[model samples]
Target chain A: MSTATLNVTTVKADFPLLGREVNGHPIVYLDSGATSQKPRQVLDALDRYYEEINANIHRGAYLIAEKATTAVEDSRAALAGFVGASAAEEIVFTKNATESINLVAHSWGRTNLSEGDVILLTTLEHHANIVPWQQLAAERGVVIRWIPLDDDGRLDLTDLDQLLDGVRLVAVSAASNVLGTLPPVRRIADAAHAVGALCLVDASQWVPHYPTNVADWDCDFMVFTGHKMCGPTGIGLLWGRRHLLDAMPPFMGGGSMIQNVTFEGFTPADVPTRFEAGTQPIAEIVGLRAAVDYLNAIGMEAIRQHELDLTAYAMRTLTERFGDDLAIHGPHDLENRGGTLSLAYRGIHPHDLSQVLDQHGICVRAGHHCAKPLMKVLGVNATARASLYLYNDESDVDALADGLAAAGDFFAF
Target chain B: MAGLEDLYREVILDHYRSPRNRGELETPPAIMAEGFNPLCGDEIQVYLLVEDGVIAEIRIGGQGCSISQSSASMMSAAVLGRTPDGAREVLRSFKEMMSIHEHGLDGEPISTDDQPGASGLGDLEALRGVVKFPVRIKCATLGWNTLDQVLDQTGT
Candidate 1:
């Protein structure tokens, strides 16, 4: 393994769930791509929020309300810094990444898109990224275009110019949840800008494992979730360019989002507040801030480097153990991929494989992973995916290998 | 480990390796129904040729995991020549076996009788172990559920 600056063993010790046993074996969690295990820091932050400062934010005159409001805004500022946004006002909090994407689709898409306009997307998107556009296209009579994938699972951008001809917006993923392929978002964003179209990135899988600078990416909008970054669920972020957010209409209309109360007409508040409708998830935001602090303490570069080393080690180990019996999907080069590994093995079904692996206390995902279009392109109905994160180590990879060997032996003719 | 062995029995593997009734039936007299387990991307299409209230022929198609495919294979073998009401009874019996009911074999003794139509489930008892694995219970029942839908649509 490569020399990581952060100590993974110490990091793993912070997560209480990792210490538990499943069935009779120690639990080896390799499913962080679905949702990461939370550290004690985040859990404690959430607990502290409920215990010490619990109140409705933004409207109350009580001291606790002021503290809650400050804490929530502080979290927004920290998350903005995490993704390199210029100001906290640019970060709009929503229920989750899925809701963030839907907010943009309802607010910006309905306003900007017209009949015959095109929304270009990539095949690597999750269902959250695909369904909203499909719904919008069906509603507005807009045409949707796709950027295809190469044989190795990276985006085939050779036909990108042709696809961008009438495109009004280009929405794509920064990383593939199934294939682990990291597309060049900067280039795609630049291409979209050259053609006078906007660019939106689904960074749900990217920000957790790597350092994300939305300004450096030069995209019009970006989104990510808190749960995938070792925080609590029910809180996610949508970071958009200041001008674009100011120009769009409010996503939800409610008490906190309005500037005036009248039956005749009402003016919406400023960008971020206009997007947040009801009472916010205050405890989740506090947990997210703590998660950001935890990740920052370890350093994003160190996490990325450590995952790269683990990915290489995993690929080498699995290939040595299974050889041609295993078919791994994604870019062959480690530099072009993340730590997610989706595998098809020995004609053993992914569900059966997952069941067998469960006997050994190994947690892996089995199925389309909400990327059915990519699964169709890969020519498989489903794949077993084992994704890695900061706390995962070489021993986890060994356990996975042992589990797969057992599955092979059990299913052998 | 014994749970795993019970789940992937030799008979289940045999059917998965060499599935029976795995093609299409001519459509003039055949009714088709498709089932999908969206959670796992397992898709199965069941085609039935019914004549005079009896299933004349049955075919299973599509792709999925061993449990789903093998279950479909075994289902076609069990229901091919039975009448629509008989097929419905068989479906109910199979679902009862897969469900968490108190009257299930969990509290009762295991039986070794292989007599046809003696135990109400016949070879379908091979899939009894699926109930233990809650997540995979859907995979094991995709075909039978589709067959139920098709038979319902065909007015039985």
Candidate 2:
């Protein structure tokens, strides 16, 4: 094994799901861009919480209630520190990145944006970022504008100033789900800030692969999901400036988010709690903290380097083997991309391509990947994507290569 | 354990490479049905030339996985020139066989002849292996679903 492989394997021991077999062959999981596999440490943390201190946080004066409250607050603090935020109050627990984006769209978007005002978003954003704004625009008569993408799937920064003019809010993904291109986010944020527009970053694909500093990016709001980062599902986070969150109205009204309830009037709680109205996913939060710690232990910089190297290897080997028959989507250069590779065989459907890969125990995602507008822009109905994460290696790429060849031959007479 | 080779049988590859009845039908008096797999974005549009309750001609167009394409290719060939009732019976049999579980027709024969007495699938029997791979079953049934939709339009 190479040094990267050795490092990944050492990390694999912590995740039990990596050792399983699918279709009677060792599972070569290449679908991490969809959802990552969880580690034993994360699972153990969840189990420990349920077993030891299962109680409604801040509800009762009992010892367990205090312990639960401490655990939740401690996790919030850790998460705040992980993202280099000012305080735990800046982080609000959400269901997923989808909910976070929706919360912002429904709360700030409905209240602030108006007719003739434009919401600027990148052409390559996930549906979560695009659809919410589109819905809000349709409802409120706000005009929606797009920052066009280049041939390499990178953002076209040439018109950044023009696009930001009169834009109430700018939303974009940190990384494209299909092309894997990391946008010039800091520059985009700076441009948006210059125009007095709030920039929201959908870091669902980026936070798992790289270290994220909201303060460094100076983004007004950011959203990410836990499952994509090897944490439990049904849990995500929305990080926003304390002032912006405080000013926005409550997204959902419920018991915990209210300071005092009366027949005449009800007062809202503070920032994060005011947004998080329902009983949160307590276990998922605990598990996400463990996932954060796991990433910290391995170090994000080293992991990012490992993934970059793997992506380079995959691009080189795949391009050399299949040539033009394998049409790779997104950026041409590895440095301009993330770990996801969306490609299509010349005349074969992605469903067939994925089936052949499944036979080799290689898990890959196939289809539009929830970016239909981008798919129409790319001029294809669907494409097969093989995504890499911390646990993937050269062998997995080899499996995908072999599977593509088999699909090519099978589809050909 | 069924291998990839088993999943991609020679017959399936043959049907996929040189699909049968792969064309558009005449527009007038033609009923069309489309089937889509949201998971893989596989799609099929089936057109039938029906004449006084009989399937006078059948044609299909769309893009999909090899199994779905091949299945549509074979389906257009299978149900052509058969009465709506006869075609539904044959489709029912094909669906039953594709289920893979025991349905009490193991010893019985499926005929492929176009004559009034011929009543079973001969070349399509190769799809029996698809039962081992459950996900591919939908691929094999896209054309059949279209057939059902066409039959539904026939009011049979």
Residue range A1-413, candidate 1, lDDT tens digits:
32348789999999999999987899999999999999999999999999999999998999999999999999999999999999999999998999999999999999999999999999999999999999999999989999999989999999899999999899999999999999999999999999999999999999999989998999999999999999999999999999999999998888799888788999999889999998989999999999999999889989998999899999999999999999899998987899999999898889989998999999999999999988899898999999999999999999999999999999886
Candidate 1: Cα lDDT at B146? 96
Candidate 2 lDDT over B1-156, as tens digits, reads 666675677877888888888878766678888887766666788888888767888888988777888888888788888898989988998887776332323533323322322336867876776766677787788789888987888877
Give the range where candidate 2 chain A is weakest over 10 consecutive residues by summed lDDT: A1-10
Using all chains and alpha carbons, the TM-scores for the candidates as numbered come to 0.96, 0.89
Per-model C-alpha lDDT, please?
Answer: 0.91, 0.85
Structure candidate 2, residue pairs in collision: B110-B120, B111-B120
Error of 1 at A92 (Å): 0.4
CAPRI docking class of candidate 2: medium
Candidate 1, residue A107: the lDDT equals 97
Q: Where does candidate 2 chain B have its weakest 10-residue lDDT segment? A: B110-119
